[model samples]
Target: MDAAVAEAHVAALQGEDAHAAEPFRMSAVKFAMWLFLASEVMFFAGLLGSYLVLRFSHANQFSEEALALNWPLATLNTVVLIGSSLTMALAVSAAQAGQAPRTARFLGFTFVLGVVFLVVKAIEYSTKIHHGIVPSMSLFYASYFTMTGCHALHLIGGLVPVTVVGLRALRGRVDGGKVELVGLYWHFVDLVWIFLFPLLYLI
Candidate 1:
């Protein structure tokens, strides 16, 4: 059979129809993306729950403590994150369209943005510490550490995959929906920060 016909037939398969043909077997990659995203949902839920607990239980302390946070720095990081998300989306689009070089370029830009975010976060963390707002000092500081630290780690985690994808794009190796998948994950990381900024930093 022609490749197009075979691909069309396989693409049309659903549920048990997939088992009818070898080429129509359900995809491990697709399954993994869903499973990974489910786990990510749980992870973010836990973080948000922690934030809520700390916010309401010690509302006055948290609010008072939050007064010292640098809004200018947080706002700058927010713009950086949103920009990275845009680059990520473009990389995904380029990859889907088989423009490997463009995909690599955009992915590289996204990775650089991630690095810049981490740097800014490090600066923020340093400044906070210098001001003696250590986690041991207040419930708010502890929650801030736990929540923002986890998010920083997540941003770091996002860095690795974006770099990997960019490298693969350079080598002309990655394809399919891999770019889109990374784009989704990276966008989610950015989205999480978006919610976190106003809630934790501005509020």
Candidate 2:
């Protein structure tokens, strides 16, 4: 989308501001969310860098360790995350259209999918633990635990804001920009897993 158009969209969502020098630019909330997402990009980049280095240096061990991962379960979780992203997008679209009920329902579906992804991840983790595969087991296992565990933690952390947004949507208080902001974060989380899935499981 054109930058000006995107700016206008955000401005519309935030409502016209009387005190601003330039009107219909971008909302403060959306600006801050983009900055926050930039930081998150750097954080995940560092983790992925470290993981790639370890994997390259210990290729044989990493390959062997990767075999223990439950590919079927991880694939299912990936599908769940993808579905959540779809619902999140719908929620944003609904909110933009001022359809509060539809927005709330879509947000609820997204939340449920997020929970299901985490539950599937938990099952995978338990199986690994049962097989004595843990961070202390080896360097490969350590990287696996660190990367996947961090992503899972993020998913857990995301539940709070998603729940709040969903509740606000139900109560008819959510604005378009707010839903878009939350959707951006939710999509980023899902995108990270898209990169992670093949790296940790399929590779």
Best by TM-score: 2
TM-score of each: 0.83, 0.86
Clashes of each: 0, 0
Local distance difference test, each candidate: 0.86, 0.90
**Candidate 1 clashing pairs?**
none
Q: Tell me the tens digit of each residue's lDDT in model 2 across 59-135.
A: 88898879878899999999999999999999999999999999999999999999999988888888889887779
The pairs that clash in candidate 2 are none
Q: How far in Å is the alpha carbon of 115 misplaced in model 2?
A: 0.3
Off by over 4 Å in 2: 1-24
- Top-scoring candidate (lDDT): 2
- lDDT for model 1 comes to 0.86
